[model samples]
Target chain A: MNAKDVPHQGSFRSSLYLFIILMIIWLVLTNSLKTEELLSGLIISLLLTHFLSANYRELGLPRLRLKRAANFIAYVFVLLSEIIKANFDVAYRVLHPKMPIRPGIIIIKTSLKQDIAKVILANSITLTPGTFTLDIKDDALLIHWINVKSEEEGEAAKRISERFEKYLKVVFE
Target chain B: MKKGVSIILLLILLWGVVAALSEMPFGKAKLEVAGHYTDYGKEDTGAANIVTSVVLGYRGFDTLGEVTVLFLACIGLAVVLSTLKKQGCGARQTPSLILNTGFRFLFPLILLFGTYVFMHGHLSPGGGFQGGAVIASGFVLMYLSVPKIKRLNHFVSTLFESVGGLIFLVIGLIGLKLGSQYFLNNFLPNGEFNTLLSAGIIPVIYIAIGFKVGSELSKIIDVLLEESE
Candidate 1:
């Protein structure tokens, strides 16, 4: 059987390629004329073999969604703008005497199918100022908010998820 | 037993998938920081090795957290082992002839090489963590070959780790106290670029890290070996 057909151990050629690459890297980094560093590098490379030997038999990732890539770019642009705007808004609040902190956790249930997309959405939410990723449970993100204009949790979740997840579903899931 | 091993194998396979997926463009995009290396490298606070500079200088707070992780691991090991109350396999007969002779001859050379790596870390890419691990392995070899080699003393290991932690903090604080910003370089005079003494607190800090890592790892090996025996 072909090495690729094994479904557990990756192609031997790929592993050899990686080992060579790592050896070259070690050589360049250490610049040691002595055999000791070479020996050490070989040992280290062997240790790293455990990581390379796996050929992704589980968590089968979905095919790339190219049409969604355009949407992802657009979404990212929107997200960046929103973050800048939020920063100024937060700064204004901070300087204000009221210190108006409607500090509460907002739970957002996202429709993003892929684990990768869900992670990006969660990370993006946390990246925005005045928000923190408190927990992620069952495709739902629990985010801590510094301020809330509306106490309605569902509306808040809807608004936040809409900006990020639409493009995310296309790119990752 | 077969089922348990299969479960572990399954988890490993899943992790392998994630690791491979993460290396792809989408995965890389998530991991990549938005910064130019030249711009960041020039503005880096201390040391020549960009990785070290990032870990110890720019992200000193993160380095503190990393050290805390090691500290936690050490503490956890101590706690777990303390409860076990088992003696090490110190009474096991020492390896005869071949292994003992070989270890006795190679041990010092291995130690010398480890020290060389630690000391030259700034000049090259290897740093405290990598060099210390090498040194620890040398000690491990001896422990495996010679059962009677006194287990790394718990108190000594604790002292080394604690003092290393303290020294790391003190150096950072001193830099701050002297009107340098947190983890600022040239707090101690920056020697010439390629020389052993060039990176100021970097070499000193790495040595402390080496001591901490070496002792902690040795202790870990000693504990595990003891339990096995």
Candidate 2:
């Protein structure tokens, strides 16, 4: 998703994208289809989208494609499964009297270029049972591990980020 | 020793304040007005949300005063904090990549939510003050996330704060001229029951107050951030 490829300046497309997102949020929140609510929402969202005239310059809305959307959906499912599995791991550890744990902070590098993708990846890591995202330095993430399986950066990145990164790379890159 | 003395002072002050406030007949002094507002507030103010009616309908002048107080506090903070900074602000560690990148996407959504909250103040649980605080929180989020984020244009922030106040004042003046000879009267037709355009000037005043408070709070955050840096 190269932002530069998209015509960003004074583009109605950006406004339209923002409008759709805001309208969805508005409808979901208000849960009303009355003409008054719709009309007011339309006016309000439209006016707010006018701020796009300023610097939402790098609005990183993903390019919509069937394959990419499918990838994103897959990514969400993968994330949910990972979180649930991690939750059970946590539960198992907590229920056990003698806690089986090795905790350490490991720095893992990512191939991902976009900050948004990196953030999502970090969030996914944090949500999972053992690994907590402590910080991000450029493309590298400092993750605190409940069990330090691999001291090596490459192995750790593979163990932690690789599963999510493949789907994200295809979707985001 | 100093901490103990301060605690004693705080306790004495709290006791004195609580003793004075205990005799005020809490929440019962305005029964007739409260009854009138509760029973007929909907029809009278055309706001289904009774709190909205009481706030923007009956106590609008007070809301104006509150917003002014906030604006003054922002100005006071800026002046006081700017002097506290030693020379140019010192450099700090840049925020993580996740935060720096995350803010751009989240900033607009938060702003929209705040707008929604304030815009729907008439029909919803939230009002201008809450929504404005929410909007200001969005800026605070951005500040924490983006270390390289440029300073807010003081000119623009001040303009918005003043314009919002002016709108609130002008609407009151308009109310006085056209409707009842009272300040901040609901002069305009309250469109329909429980609709967006209903509540007469409540939504208008609330939106202005939202802008005023949001800008003022954002400015305060900017000043505080600068001082810390």
Candidate 3:
């Protein structure tokens, strides 16, 4: 659904929040406190925030609380370590004389209600060694796995997405 | 027979590359103009990046012509794509939760990055063209992932594109009126070197260029996406 169709509240406050954030980014990027720079930045930031916050409020954009934000950061760290482990696994498999790979596309279901969380789950799965997300149809993800460890879809989905989905749900949902 | 022809063509390309490489030795200074630009570019243009001075200062008219060519290309793309039978919006499938969420999260970050790139064009490797392309890519990602959202507003994009072009032209005209009777001449005070506010008219022109290019490209993408909808 288009954001314009949705009803929302406190748009002005949200716009102010966006303006302040954008101004800080502008300050950092420009690395200047000159009158002209500040003036232009204020004007541009206000315009952008006004336009953007309207859509944001309409969309019912998720509020990123401090606790969730911190959890998201921690989640990133965990994903990175998992990626590194996957890389090592791929390398070991490639270096082995006997290429032991049973590549197959498996259909796996995700319970993630938010689009962002589902995307994160897919990306994390793809980043992790030996699994690549090929497509997303409804609640199911089509994944290409280097080795099909299980024939059961439930078992495969659990093994692949369960680790990341828990944190994603908390961060996004 | 086809294989032999392909091999012969490859060898010819290889020979040409080798010959060109031999003419210009690796890891050696060449091009007398390069030395001149590096030595006096800062003093003359007051821009820290000699490359920016060269592109937007030394041969600004040429850059303007290039921008016109790009504008024409976008116009041509629109003309060509308009004739195609447009797809109904209903044909599009809803994107997965993951793609939709990821796109929303990254869209603002990409816009911020693009702005940073164009703003620092005078001081860094990036410029209007690169930044504009980045912004367009962000739009493309949005179009791909979130098909249900309303398309990019055509009126706003076209307005920004025209406004940017107008600003560039006005600046050039002002340069002719105030500075050396040349178009795009530095009219305002070239502020202190290596500063954000430095390089009179260069940053302004680049910002104009960034907006123009960003809008034009995003418009082209919007058309293409809609045509396939």
Candidate 4:
């Protein structure tokens, strides 16, 4: 049933739900159920509800398709490994006497469609080593790379986006 | 039928399910991951209260962002209220003797309690965000009881928010410069465990956060009240 049809579906109900959820969170975090903890949780939940009620439409996100989700997880693992390698590489380059930083921005196209997925992809790009996602435009992410070893920037973008964006579209969109 | 409505419903359902799942035995892994700040506190930062460490130190950037959100909200409220003429501004009646007397009695004690929470955040489970809200509640009580009195000053509130935000940013920048990774601990000493002076930069940061939050919230309440009027 649509939420509007349900009784107590307004801000009051939402606040109550938020309070319970926050209380649960507080419990988990502190592993305590003291009066102070409950009071604190209620206060936090009240604040959250007040702030988030306007944006309740974005509250819950759906699960990805299993195969696609698995692929995404695998992609993340690969991405993390790549990021660690890149961090070390960057650290080495920075510490090296050569100091090899040829910083420049590059634009790369992505295949993800959903806005949420696109945002996740963009953030992922930034979270990884060396490259920062500066701007996203027309299905393309403008990235600032600390160092560009290869002349073919498009190759790097395509390779990186294709690795995750394809799976992301299946999972998130 | 609207895509937006459907999306909202889906999200609510997602949250409901996640909240339920998080209560299960397997939830520890999820909590460990989700509570990234707690992870830092437990593993590297050595702070007893994971939430305090997270709010005050690790992932402090997020806390800073949260405070900025409060500031923006206050500013937005102020803009909205400035255009409206104040009507029904004063208390309709002298607050009942009980409420006025109770508030007068409780406000100072509550304020002190809130301060205590912020000061001892590292050793215990309270911090700036929690303590700040408590202080704001005290102001709210005063506002409720003595409506004619301007409980908090807007300019002062804004000043606190800006200064608090700037201090948080400066700390981040200092961390970057010190070569101990961004938002590194031990920039100040961890201090004695149970004392108000303990937990390195934590109490200092919490105090800043408390001021920032208290001001922002009071401003929000003032604007919201004006709008209601």
After the best TM-score superposition of candidate 4, give how far the Cα of residue B5 lies from its true spot, in angstroms: 9.0
Docking category of candidate 4? incorrect
> Per-residue lDDT for A1-173 in model 4, tens only?
12122233344543454445555655565555656555665665566556444222232223425786687788788778867877897899889998989988777877755444666677677777787877666577777888865547568776556666766666655
Interface RMSD of each: 18.6, 2.2, 3.4, 18.7
Candidate 1 lDDT by residue in tens digits, B39-125: 464344335676766666666678667777887887788778778865543567645323443454345445545655776666667
Pairs clashing in candidate 4? A60-B11
lDDT of 3: 0.79
Top candidate on DockQ is 2
| lDDT tens digits, residue span B1-229, model 2 | 9999999999999999999998878766567778899899898898888998888887777788887899889878877776663767577776666666567667777888898889889998988888899999989987897666576778999899999999999998987888568888888889888877888899988899898889889988888777677
Q: What digit string (tens of lDDT, one per residue) describes model 4 on residues B1-229?
A: 6999999999999999999988878624556555666555554455677776666666666877787888788788788678777676553755543354345444544665666566557778788788888888887887787666655776787798889878767776777777687654447766545444556766777778887887788778867865664
Using Cα atoms, each model's DockQ against the true complex is 0.01, 0.55, 0.33, 0.01
Candidate 1 vs candidate 2: the TM-score winner is 2
Specify the highest-TM-score model's number. 2
What is each predicted model's overall lDDT from 0 to 1? Answer: 0.66, 0.83, 0.79, 0.66
Per-candidate RMSD vs. true structure? Answer: 22.7, 3.8, 4.0, 24.0
| DockQ category of candidate 3 | acceptable
> What are the clashing pairs of model 1?
B88-B226
Clashing pairs in 3: A115-B97, A116-B101, A118-B98, A119-B98
